[model samples]
Target: MSRKQYSKELKLELVKKHLEDEISYWKLGKEYGIEASIIRRWGHKYETFGEDGLEKQNADLCNYSAEFKKKIVLEYLGGNITSQDLAAKYKIHAPSTVRTWIKQYNNHEDLTNSRKEGVYLMAKNGARKNTTLEERINIVEECINTGCNYASTANKYGCSYGQVYVWVRKYKDKGIEGLYDRRGKNKAISQLSDIEKLKAENRLLKAQTQQQQMEIDFLKKLDEIERR
Candidate 1:
């Protein structure tokens, strides 16, 4: 499924609500059907980069100096900041972009300027490949094991980055059974066996627990940064 797009005006309005109105992220998210983390990200970007940060990123690839990338990667590795904060500070398109750089740095990959911008563009925005269930499982597993580097995993599997991200999210929320193609099927919870239902519930609980812990960590870090 394609990801939903929000307008610039709407994004600004939501950010303002969080910033100016003192509305909680969870309340806004529940009312708007967006994840609280996403809303929080928007607010952070707006704070860091102003209105321009609310704009959708262009598909055109961005080139960064090797030195610049190394600086950010090292800062991230220093454990003083989150990838999302670093992305906002540097005006990077997304936190995932920062994570990709960190992944490359950890793997001893070259952090050279993108001499082949077209290849990066195609890899990021090209047509997604249709893969078998086995391939999807393998891709999801590798993505998880590799620190959830969706960009690299997508390139490795010849799929769109969005595909890798969505698959991993689904796997987290529903387990291995979620990776199956269920288009045009209306499988209800009532139709599931007891074991299947229990497994799905467990997966959902696990995902929620992880999200809660991440939020807690982010808030604690934010407090520390503010104190400093």
Candidate 2:
């Protein structure tokens, strides 16, 4: 069955009815043709984000810093504000963004790492990088020393500015341990040093250069034989 989408105005009306009229979720679902569970979720989002929580968000439209996400998640968990209210306060276009952050925090997932790097969200194109724990610590420290200059830190570290910003925020919120890569199963870059990474890249470049040189020499020999 095709899922029905509700408009912002409709969602607001429904939530208001649920709240002011104190109607049951089952009754609301029956009246609106939405499931009780869905109504409950809507009610929760309404409490968190308000009317804006009902609006759909464009996936490619925005990128939020890790610090902002952490703050929102913590605030929601703290029970002081709804996700909708937090979204409005932060000027976040999507309330669902807060929902995702809250879910990940509850799951004990590291929010510092971008999903592209196997964290939470899809990586921006060609922007994903493998950074070690030590490197993450250094990056965060440098960002702090530079007054949280994320762009400069990212340039110095050859990483995305967004990634650097996240690392610094995570460090401040969770201390040094937050920078640690927690995935035990996918540990390809674990415990590796910056020097080791550079050396590996250098080795690959040298091998490619040698192969190119060999091809050039073979072409030269072939040309001479053809001239004969």
Candidate 3:
């Protein structure tokens, strides 16, 4: 799936709603069809670095000095904060970059400013690689242990970033049972408890209702514009 890019204006608007209006991230996420975690991260960034934190980072402008990388890496290793928090605090684009630096430091690898030699600078989109259940479990464990660093985990395991992210999410939502490949098997409603089925249906219905409401509001604005 293609990643969606939000404009700075939209980001500021959402961040304001989250901060000034005291809107909950979960509510905003459901209403706007974005992850609550992502919204929360945006709020943190906005708080830590102001509007500049919400600005989209240009890859060309991401060059960091080796000394800077070492400083951030050491701070992370100190365990005072999470990688996500560190990224927000330091204005880094991705927490995975911080995790990658920590991994390199722990492995006694050279920390260089050269992007060519940087593992974290690899392409975000990569070919999906098939893995055994054991490998998947290990990958998910490492990802969780490393503060959910999907990009670095994906790079280390030779899989796509999406795969690592999805696997980790599934693991969190359903535990070990979620890791099993049930593609060809029937996903019958009988497998779910009554409460589980009802909850799932309610979530779907809520999303649909919200979507319809947005559509109606959009059409109303269009009609009003036409009448003027």
Q: Alpha carbon lDDT of residue 54, candidate 2?
A: 61
Tens-digit lDDT track of model 1 for 1-228: 998899878888888776545699999999999999988777655543344457797332456778888999989867788899998998876786687787677655677674343344224344567776657767876666555656557667777655676678777776766777666344444566888757655654555565456556656754766676
Candidate 2 error regions (>4 Å)? 1-126, 185-228
lDDT of each: 0.67, 0.59, 0.63
* Candidate 3: stretches off by over 4 Å: 1-5, 8-55, 72-125, 184-228
Each model's TM-score?
0.47, 0.29, 0.42
Q: Relative to the unseen true structure, what is the C-alpha lDDT of residue 223 in candidate 3, on a scale of 0 to 100?
A: 61
The C-alpha stretches of model 1 lying farther than 4 A from their native spots are 1-60, 65-67, 75-96, 103-118, 121-125, 183-228
Q: Any idea what lDDT model 2 has?
A: 0.59
Q: Model 2: what TM-score? A: 0.29
Evaluated with lDDT, which candidate comes out highest? 1
Q: Count the backbone clashes (under 3 Å) in each candidate.
A: 0, 7, 0
Model 3 lDDT vs. the true structure? Answer: 0.63
lDDT leaderboard ranking: 1, 3, 2
The TM-score of candidate 3 is 0.42
